[model samples]
Target: MSGRRTTHEDAHDPAPTWTPRLGDLAHDSSADRTGVVVEVPGDGVFSYHLRPERGGADPEWTAPADGSTLSPADD
Candidate 1:
């Protein structure tokens, strides 16, 4: 068997462009998570938040933007 551990790769489809994280909000660094990019919404802040959302699903904005603002993606 392949010693390499299994990552969050699709079974039928090929691997996604990005990976998926459980609850990482700050999209500062390109993480191994799935999702596009939203506005940073902050100045002087060298960070961004990425969630499994689209259209209007905004990232966290209050505090700890990457704490618990990640919402589920729609089918």
Candidate 2:
């Protein structure tokens, strides 16, 4: 077999880091939930605030804007 890895082999690899922008929909991998990007303070450890896209009474939550814990939500 070849030493190089194939796409299939990479499928199990960790997801690439994703940077979240304002008004962008992102998924919280750690929380296993989806939310909309509502704020980007650009400071502090948790620099992003995400609100539920469905418009719920649930309060907004904070996340890291560095994409280490967030990914673009799949449509």
Candidate 3:
């Protein structure tokens, strides 16, 4: 038999969560801008690059706290 043994904790462990992907819509209340997720990368902190829904030159980078005002955009 294999050497590994199972435990109750292991069985009850939650699965890994997921993050947003490119093309997903998000909003920044502080900036009052709605945009699509252009890129997801770490720049010292976990941040998202967003392309403005109203059209812009370059995507803006923002690091929104876990329970902050940032939220999914309706469009």
Model 3 TM-score, 2 decimals:
0.50
Error of 1 at 26 (Å): 13
Task: Quantify all predictions' global Cα lDDT against the true fold.
Answer: 0.40, 0.80, 0.66
The stretch of ten residues in a row with the least summed lDDT in candidate 1 is 61-70
- Model 1 regions lying over 4 Å from their true place: 1-30, 54-75
Candidate 3 structure lDDT: 0.66
* Residue-wise C-alpha lDDT for candidate 2, range 1-75, written one tens digit per residue: 878666986878876666688899999888787899888865554578889989879777887656677888999
lDDT of 3 by residue, 7-75 (tens): 989878764444556777877677787787776665564666678776768557674534154568775
- lDDT score of residue 20 within candidate 2: 81
Clashes of each: 7, 0, 0
TM-scores of all models? 0.24, 0.66, 0.50
lDDT of 3 at 17: 48
Number of the top lDDT candidate: 2
Residue 10 displacement in candidate 2 (angstroms) = 21
